[model samples]
Target: MSSLGGQPILILKEGSQRTRGRDAQSGNIAAAKAVASAVRTTLGPKGMDKMLVDTIGDVVITNDGVTILKEMDIEHPAAKMMVEIAKTQDDEVGDGTTSAVVIAGELLKRAEDLLDQDVHPTVIAHGYRIAADKAQDILNEIAIDIKPDDIEMLKKLAETAMTGKGAEAAKEKLTELVVKAVTMVADADGTVDTEYVKVEKRVGGSIEDSEIVEGMIIDKERVHPAMPRIVKDAKILLLNAAVEFKKTEVDAEISITSPDQLQMFLDEEERMIRGIVDKIVASGANVLFCQKGIDDIAQHYLAKAGILAVRRVKKSDMEKLARATGAAIVSSIDAIAPEELGKAGTVEEKKVSGEEMIFVTECENPKAVSIIIRGGTEHVVDELDRAIEDALRVVSVAVEDKKFVAGGGAPEIELSLRLREYAATVGGRAQLAIEAFANALEIIPRTLAENAGLDPIDMLVALRASHEKGGANAKYMGLDVFNAASGDMLKAGVVEPLRVKTQAVSSAAEAAIMILRIDDVIAASKSSAPAPGAEDMGDMGGMGGMPPM
Candidate 1:
């Protein structure tokens, strides 16, 4: 007779073997389908938000599919694979995590159906690739060639991307600025250099004098009482590090023992600083870009001496500015030259209560320019700063590449339809795989539907059928992907996937098919074993519910 523990273990092994009899392909398909179903209803701008609650009771709410997938504590091996697809999508587009996974799941589901009919996996993969290529073609056909004159459309696109993130008006304004900045840097080679535009925030007031500068702007006031306020034919000095002398051991401890001693210390400090500034001026330098700190007394002296100085220049900014202006950072001020003095065009200051805003423009062939964004509150300024940053990046990409697809869920939807067409031509197993790829593309619409609490399965089927019948079109709207009938989907109030039937169905189908193709699972063993006598032994009583060997 077998021991109790050993006998139970034997029985478990038998049961496992019996369960393992199922085909690996079918198992993978099923797992993918499950994951696809989870995020099907949260796709479009009208898409509802997902509330993820962790075991610790912490909650996060957002409509970003990528964020949702990342936060989920996924345990299933198949489900984890789907999450990776979402991650890849997010990295590429900065959005559309849900759509990629959803379409992938749908593709898998369709593949499973094809597999059941004896289609080969290799054929399905080939079909899927063909479909993807075709889908790209379709996208090109539908893409609206955005021109530089279409500033309004650009604004709308930027607004759509930043709608729920806060500060709508600011976002639009910043978008316009980004477009202008990009236009400024457009080269003969058709490339836009983003290195020229810099978004900076300082403690000063608003920029009243926002003129184009040929040279770099320095935020610091004059270095010394003797430094000149304005200098013509200014020789500019760019320093990568600080000019202040290090404190000696005796200098730190010295107190005002006598008026003579105090005056001597002050005079020494001033002399040291002024000597450096004088050296710079003697070298024919009128302006200075200091990466590190400058002495207060020295600034006063420099100002009195008719020299202009800018302190705390970042190393990267210094390099760019230097390259653009043909100015070099020298170790000693004696190397500066009047010929090297880039012209300073305009410099003005505005005051807002305790804050002062300085506008410096028209410097010597300056490449890097700074836009110091200021606001009353930290949150307000931060939000404005972010909007400006996004606008700059988008405009830069648009100007540089002159080719890009609508970001977010739009691309995924297009991918699904293309995959479907290819799936029809492939052999049995290959058809299944192609269908799976198509389904993965559907996750976007399904996610939209689920967010709206609609039935993802029904919507996905409808979407697939609609695309199969050719009822979709692309155009300029608030969001990248919007149904023609929905007006402005991104701006119009949040919509459920079920409410927008076409999007719902399409997204669900795509997600389901994509998820249905996963076939393998590898599980790691637990590090620790159960406690002694803690295992369940089942019923000890005989006859009715007794443990049996």
Candidate 2:
């Protein structure tokens, strides 16, 4: 209150909080760095796995960056942005999630130092943008051309993706499986889709037991025990019609006045069921897969006709079956024709792990395939599934892009060198940010070295010097995580899809720049209900309504 203008004004709410300027920038940077550090150790060949137990006590064990970040329960807003970077990387390229997040964290760390020097956040962000673009150029220059027929290179790409995870022990076998799966699903246009390669996991067997099926495997059992267990030279029918009697949408009751009338009704029902069965048999289909339910009466008739039938098949499985078996799904039994039936060499019901499942196998050049993953335990099976998924995705991406780069941190070190040289041409305050970005790119090779129990500084220095002397071919010079020394990654048969590295760098830079731009943080108070005894509480007088104080 002023002496002459004796009045007071209250603007903000009582419980609101606001942080501005440097305090806000530092808080955001710290939270983002914390998130990055959380996933830091889970990178490269010697990286460790994380065993995350959810609130309900379900456990997940893997070193996959996206999986670990997704399992983490983050509350800080800036930290959540860091998690989004991993998500974006996973969605776009399916690998290098840890590299992206770690680079972003290191970028923020460098920006903090620049901030201390009175450089504006915008300038730092601008320099990062420039560095990221230039890094992509350097990557493109160093990337080697790979074709879909490059079987050896693709296998190395797959192996590089699975090196650190649970599948590392079986990398040799899994690498072949992944490459085969991708090659089988690739179209003539060189477009490879990972979806056509289905992965199914079951326990009680070793990882070596995992193999890709030339055909699809339906998890459902045969509809009737009386049906044939196996049908060789099978002519399969895919139907969407329900074999059971249709229920009337409007309720109606018919009073049967006499036994004759009731007998006639039952006879008509039997005749209708028999007619439907006869229609299917006339189509010359020895096997039936239905998307809807099959009545017991229908099953009995099908069994009598020497046809194998499975009911309640999933729609996705039905589509896959159609692709694998060369079949057309018919809507009505009356429309079933000989040409509509799908051909399979053998349709059989086999018991696996004490559960009955149907395998539709041996189609000529089938487009859809399956990989049945077997493991000795549930956890092992789950982790193996994740590892194989990463491998398949990486291989598919490699084929789709038809390009690859040397792995083991070769591309990162080379990009760092090129970026620093480019930064000199950009000489300004932004140059400082560009150099910072160059340093951030080195974290990948550095992390690889650190995880391998080597001196990161010495390794990085050696790697840089190698690139400086070796020139263009030095793109293959990177950390040798296994031997704790620098080696030629290309000669070691370690490589990755170029898209993974490019996407990681761009996405990391975007996330760091976004987080650095936030200068004010205003948080509204959470709304809470008043206590039971204080429901009638109201604003008290300024002085407790005293006349004088």
Candidate 3:
């Protein structure tokens, strides 16, 4: 609003409210910090899990950072930006989401302290950008390079990812499977897509019962009970076309006045289905996987021909089957040929947990593999699935990058130590912001300590002392939550991919800089009269425009 000769111009609507300058900055910062704090405790090996129950009473029991943030019902803009940081970090590296959010929260907290000292927001933003770039450099300097064929290091990386999750109950077995699955599906060029590694979960078994299948596993069973349950030396066919009669493009009424005509129509339909079955038989394919449904007559003919078939298979599974069994998906029945059929050692129908699933295993050389994860309960299975996904993703990333770092807050402490030294070299108001960033990086170790029920201050001091001593192994020093002391993380086999740390640092710094620069917040009125706490809490509580309770 502006004034003209003492008369209000009322540029905005009468009830709309605006918060400017210091108030706006503080409001956005507080909201963003609250979001980060929500998931801060769910960090490290000893971290806790959050059981989030939605309005419909469905429960999500896990501590995966991205999952938790996604479950929250946040309404504030700044808070949403904080969630984006976790999401981006998770998407890029598949781990370190909790550290990213916590670091971002601590960065804003320190920025608040600097704001009180008369440091401009722009200076803080500029210094954070500089510190972020330098932090990446320091991270790369401390990273250790490994070969793609280094199975032990890859296993350590996978174990590090699944340590804090519920999969820890059988981490050794699951870790081995994760590493094997990832390595099996990796290309010769050292590129791993992680999609070819499939995870299929089922209840009514112990966690240790999970095993990796050498080929694809389709969830559907045989269309006809009379079909052979097992096919040895299986020749597989992948079909996208439906086995049922094709329906007309437009709706039409069939006038059946004579019984003879109706019999002829039925006979034609049977003949067509028989023709389709004949083509599949001539292709020398003992096993059939179809993306579309199969008619009853077609199933009977296929069973009579001693062929095992599964209908209505998912499109994704079909693609995987093509890769796993070395088959091409034929769209038309006429195109079926012996050369187009895929080869597999055996295809069988197995009953798991009282449900039938087709297992196409023992392929000659499968590019795609499946892991069947069995658990005792639904919640256990769900959590295990999440843990395996994280493990698989981290292993793939490590294999592709061929670089890793020590976990358990080791990289953060090393980065902080080096960044502070760099801060002193660039002495200015920006130096203070750079130093603030250095302190903010410590939040990872501090949170790790606090979540572990240890003395954070004492641990930080000891960690710093070790880094200052500056030996060949000094940079790898990290707090051991299990032992309640500082030790060399690399020697203890606590390793993670370098990409996780780099992605976390860059994302955290960028989010902090974005939230710090907001100097104004404008909210439109929701009612004719203002409600109590509406103006203040609406902007600061991350629940903008919600009526006061």
- For candidate 1, the per-residue lDDT at 539 reads 43
lDDT (Cα, tens digit) per residue for candidate 2, span 484-518: 77889999998999999999999999999999999
> How should the candidates be ordered by TM-score, best one leading?
3, 2, 1
Predictions in order: lDDT? 0.54, 0.89, 0.92
TM for every model, in the order presented, reads 0.60, 0.94, 0.94
Candidate 3, residues 1-549, lDDT tens digits: the string is 999999988877778889999999998999989988899989999999999999999999999999999999899889999999989988888988988999999999999999999899999999999999999999999999989889998999999999989888898999999998998899999999888988998998899899999998888999999999999999999999999877789998899999999999999889989999999999898999999999999999999999999999999999999999999999998899999999999899999999999999999888999999999999999999989999999999999999999988888899898999999999999999999999999999899999999999999999999889998999999999999999999999999999999999999999999999989888887666667668664544435665545
RMSD of 2: 3.7
lDDT per residue (tens digit) for residues 151-199 in model 1: 5655655554454434454554555555666565566665656667766
The lDDT, on a scale of 0 to 1, for candidate 1 is: 0.54
Off by over 4 Å in 1: 1-43, 47-130, 144-153, 193-195, 201-236, 244-275, 295-297, 306-308, 323-326, 331-334, 348-358, 363-367, 371-387, 404-415, 445-549
**Candidate order by lDDT, highest to lowest?**
3, 2, 1
Q: TM-score: which is higher, 1 or 2?
A: 2
TM-score, model 1 to reference:
0.60
Which 10 consecutive residues of model 1 have the lowest summed lDDT?
A: 493-502
Sequence-dependent TM-score of model 3: 0.94
